[model samples]
Target: MLQRVRLAVFLFVLGGFLPSVQADEVWEFVDADGVVHIGNAAPPASRGLVWLSQTPSARGGSGSAKGKEREVSALRLPGYEAAKPHLEAAALSQSLEPALVIAVAAAESAFNVEAVSRKGALGLMQVMPATAERYGVAGRILPDGKHAAMEPKVNAQIGSRYLADLLRMFDGDKELALAAYNAGEGAVLRYGRRIPPYPETQQYVDRVMRFYRALIR
Candidate 1:
C-alpha cells in the first residue's frame, strides 16, 4: 500500500513537470536504505541510479502499451527469461543500466528472438541490419529465407553497443539517444539535438522511458 501510494505520488509529480517549457530530465536513485529518490538531477556522489530525459511534448505518448498491465505483459513475454542474461551482459559491457537495455527489448520486440519489423529491424532490440553490420553482427540467412538475427547474444550485444554510441552521441541524454535509435542519428542531428517532432520517435522514447521506470521501481 505504501509503495503504491509512493508510485502514485511520483506519477503525479511526473505529470506535473511534463509541461515545463524546457527539456526536463528526471533522475531516480535508490540509496542503501532502499528508499527511492527522484529529482531533476542526481546529487553529487550518487550511485545505483537510472534516469530518462525528454522534451515536454514527448509526454503521454502511445507508441507502446500503458499502465501496470504493460509491465506484467513484459514479464510474460515470450523469450524474456531466455534473453535476460544476454541483456544483462550486454548492458554491463556498455556500462548501462540493465533495466534500460531490457526496457528497449521489451518495447522493441517483446523479447521475441524471431521478431522482425516491416522496416527490417530484427531480433530482441529490433536492430536494423545496417546497424548490426556496423558492429559486425551479421544475421544468418534462415532456411525459410528470412534474414534472421537469430542469436540472442549477438543481437543484444549489437543493440547495446549501438544504444551506447547514441547515448554518447547525444551526450548521455537518454531520450534524445532513444530518439536517435528510432529515427536515425542523422534525423536527430538535423533537429538540433532535440527529440524530433516526429510522433513515432516521441512515442518510442516515452514508451521506453515508461518501461525503464517500471523496471527500476
Candidate 2:
C-alpha cells in the first residue's frame, strides 16, 4: 500500500502541476558534459539537466501513465551547474556573494551560456557588443562586427567583474548595484535608489530576488 501511494505521487509531479510540494526535496542531475546539477525541483530540460531520476513524488502536475515525463519533477534548469565554478570564481574575485551571481544567472538566462536577448544583449550576462569589447575581450569582430559570446567562462568572468565595478560605483548598495546590472547604472541613479519604474527593470529585479529567495529557502 505504501509503495502504491508512492508510485501514484510520482506521476503527479512530472506534468508541471506540482509546485509547492517540491520544497525540501533536493534533486541531483548530471549533464552529458559531466556537469552536476542540484535542484529543489528537477530543473529545466532546456538547461540540459534532463538525465536525472526521481526520489518519489508528491501530488501536482499533469499525469501521463507511460512516459519518461511521468516520473521526473517539473524541474527545468538551463545548464547552470556547469558554470558554477567559473561563476563562483568571478563572484569571489569581486567580493560579491556567489549566490547572487547564481540568482542573476538563473534569471538572465537559466544558465544557457549562449543566451542572446531580443535587444542584442549577448552572452550569458546579456552584454551588449560594445560593452563586451570595452572590457578587454580582444577577440576581434568579423567584418560584420560580431564577436563570439558562447564562451561561458569568459562571459561570466566579465559580467561578474562588471557587476563588481557597479557595486563600487554605487557605494556598496547591493540593490542599486543589481539595478544597474540589469537596466544600466543610469537607470538606478535616475530612480533615486529604488528599483527603476520601468516594467522590464522591475521584473528583472523581482526575478533575481525570487531566485535568491528560492536558494535561501
Candidate 3:
C-alpha cells in the first residue's frame, strides 16, 4: 500500500515532466492480490501489455522519414513544441514578446502544464489563482471536480497579460517586471520600484532572463 501511494505521488508530482505525446497513455498492473499499480511504463509483471505505441512518430507519423525528422526536431525543449502555439497566442494578445512569455513559463514551471507550486501557483507560467482572477481568467473546474490551471492557453494568456501589465507598471523595465512577477508588484513597489532583495525573486529574474536570451538567440 505504501509502495502504491509512493508511485501515485511520484506520477502526480512528475507527470508534467513526461513528453506531451506520451503523457496520456498511462499503464496499470494488478498484483496477485488485485491491488492495482500504475505508471507511465508497464511493470515487468504485465509484460507485453502496451498502452502506447513504441514508435516516437506514432502520433506525428506520416509514412515518411522526413515526417519523423520533423517530430524529432520539434522537441527542442521538453514541452516547447506542444506549448508554442499557446505561448505565441498569449504573447500576441498582450502585446508581449513570445520569447519573454516562453522564458517566464520555462523558468516558472519548465513548461509543465500540470505544475503546481508550493505557494498555490499553477500551470505553465505558475499563475497564482489571485493573479489569474485579477487578469479576469478564473480557475477552471476539471472533470474530476477540482479547480485546475493546467490548460496551457488559458494559463499562458493570464500569465502573459500579467507580465505585460507588470512591464507597463515598471515602465518597460524587464528586470523589475520579472521580479514583480516572482515576488509580487506590491513587493516591488515596497522596494522602491526595483527588484526586491528576496533571494528567490532575484534568482527567478536571473533564470527567466537567461531563458529569454537563449530563446531570442
**Per-residue lDDT for 37-154 in model 1, tens only?**
4555323432333343332454455333443444444445556799999999999999999999998886676576776665667777878888877887576676877665557888
lDDT of each: 0.66, 0.57, 0.63
Reference-based TM-score of each model: 0.65, 0.61, 0.64
Per-residue lDDT tens digits for candidate 3, residues 93-172, read 99899888887876666566666655667777877888877876677687875455557888888888889989999999
Query: Which residue pairs collide, candidate 1?
Result: none
RMSD of each: 14.4, 12.1, 11.9
What would the per-residue lDDT of candidate 2 be over residues 66-121, giving only the tens digit for each residue?
22252222224656668778788888988888877877776565566665664566
- Any idea what lDDT model 3 has? 0.63
- Consecutive 10-residue window with the lowest summed lDDT within model 3: 1-10
Runs with alpha carbons beyond 4 Å of true place in candidate 1: 1-73, 139-148
Worst lDDT 10-window in candidate 2: 1-10
- State residue 118's C-alpha deviation in candidate 2, in Å: 1.7
